[model samples]
Target: MRGGVELTDCPAQVSADFGGDTVADTADTRTPAQIEADIERRRAVLAETLDEIGVRVHPKTIMGDAKARVVSNVDHTLGRAYVRVNGVVSEVKGQFVDAEGSPRLERVVPVAVLLVGVVGLLAVGSRRRGGSARRRR
Candidate 1:
């Protein structure tokens, strides 16, 4: 807690001070442009987090406010909220608790990074083969 203010995972408490939630919902007074931008950013983060977590966020339709979804499939429970644009998510966020019920040790993985690494290795191997064929000649 820097300066005596503590950081917490509760959205309601944080949102209350901010006049409105920038989590589950957008600030109503914010201009449409501002809200749209916020939504866009949130969606990107949500998609990335979900991808990292290795879960499918089934496509859904939403009109204005950003939507947050909570799922409890594993020992961990997640409460994520994000904005949407054009039937697609624009923002995403959540909290995590590991199976051991320990707050400090949460589980997360980098699926996107793994996929990229795998693809990079395959490309490198293919290129190496072509180079070897030329060198043999």
Candidate 2:
């Protein structure tokens, strides 16, 4: 046996039992050159298959595919977030706008009052801290 393959003197019996025809061992009458050529052909085919598989499972190929998937997911997430934010902004704007597209004073006045109150509280806190720092200095 060569390379775990049985080198038979009567391959016709093997083919008959296997119910298949051999390429180089047709009628069990292959020359040595035919056998060598068949072996070389099979080796070439195997090398090509290995090369293809290597490219498919390569680190760079795998990383590139992963990066593409991540970028696509990020883009989809950002698109959905932008749509949701825009929808919320439009709803808020609608609440503050009248049928004539004029600003509603009632809503605007309350929001402005709240904002001013927050700012005044922050200013008062900062002034008190500044006064204490001045006393230390």
Candidate 3:
């Protein structure tokens, strides 16, 4: 009880009078039983705190927390990307469709024709290659 840890009859009053200092200059007035009880309570609290610290520093716990953070970040990034792509698609569609949602034939026809031309060229190129290979064989 050299420290102010000695149980006081009026701890609140003692703290208020002494600027809330836990160490007091007063003599230990707690009975042996009271001191023992206080020690036991302090030990239990200390043990619980140590257990919590151990769990917090454990490798598995740290890994789990890191994984959760990574997953959250990835999900957030993918969600934003999806929103941006959807916005781009909507903008492109808007350009090809009018206010009434009808296809702008002028714009649609040109794009369709361009795609068809590309596909036709690829098919013809492949067929020529195949025919030449067969003739060589």
Candidate 4:
């Protein structure tokens, strides 16, 4: 069986190098204020693992029914939109177009704007009926 290819054991330990504590015993070994407090505790554990994967498992996963549209360059402040089926969340501002056509945000809307509020309520109902008409005496 030499060179015939046959290897199969069974264990589940693990640690070799990838476990850390080597690299010449981490060179300087903690200092500079404990390495900036371990880089602020690893950036607060990577901001709580990106808030548990972008605001709690990104709405739950995504891809509710795919093929949905309407996306602008939203910055923040409750432009909320998140959901991802198959992967979990389900639906919330989901999108498509991947191969680099551009737009791509796939869910994450906590309170999106909603069509700039129906165009500011039809611009205050055409500026309140465009004039005035009230003189009860």
For lDDT, the strongest prediction is 3
Q: What's model 2's TM-score?
A: 0.66
Every candidate's lDDT: 0.50, 0.81, 0.82, 0.46
Per-residue alpha-carbon lDDT of model 3 for 1-137, expressed as tens digits? 23234334533223223345544444556677876887898799999999999999999999999999999999999999999999999999999999999999999999999999999999999999999999998
- Scanning candidate 4 in windows of ten residues, the lowest lDDT window is 6-15
Per-residue CA lDDT of model 1 for 1-137, tens digit only, reads: 22233224323222323444433332345666765786788799998998865544334423111243222422133222222242242122223334464442222345456778999999999999999999999
Against the correct fold, how does model 4 do in TM-score?
Answer: 0.23
**Candidates' TM-scores?**
0.22, 0.66, 0.79, 0.23
- What is the per-residue lDDT of model 4 for residues 12-122, given as tens digits with 9 covering 90 to 100? 221234344542222344457865776688699999998777753453344332323222334232244332243333222235334565545443232245567778999
Pairs clashing within candidate 1? 42-90, 42-91, 42-92, 43-90, 43-91, 46-92, 82-91
Stretches > 4 Å off in candidate 4: 1-16, 19-23, 29-32, 39-41, 60-137
lDDT-better candidate, 2 vs 3: 3
lDDT, ranked from best to worst? 3, 2, 1, 4
- Over 6-84, each residue of candidate 2 has an lDDT whose tens digit, in order, gives 4454434222223344433335556778767877987999999999999989999999999999999999999999999
**Order by TM-score, highest first:** 3, 2, 4, 1
Collision pairs in model 2: none
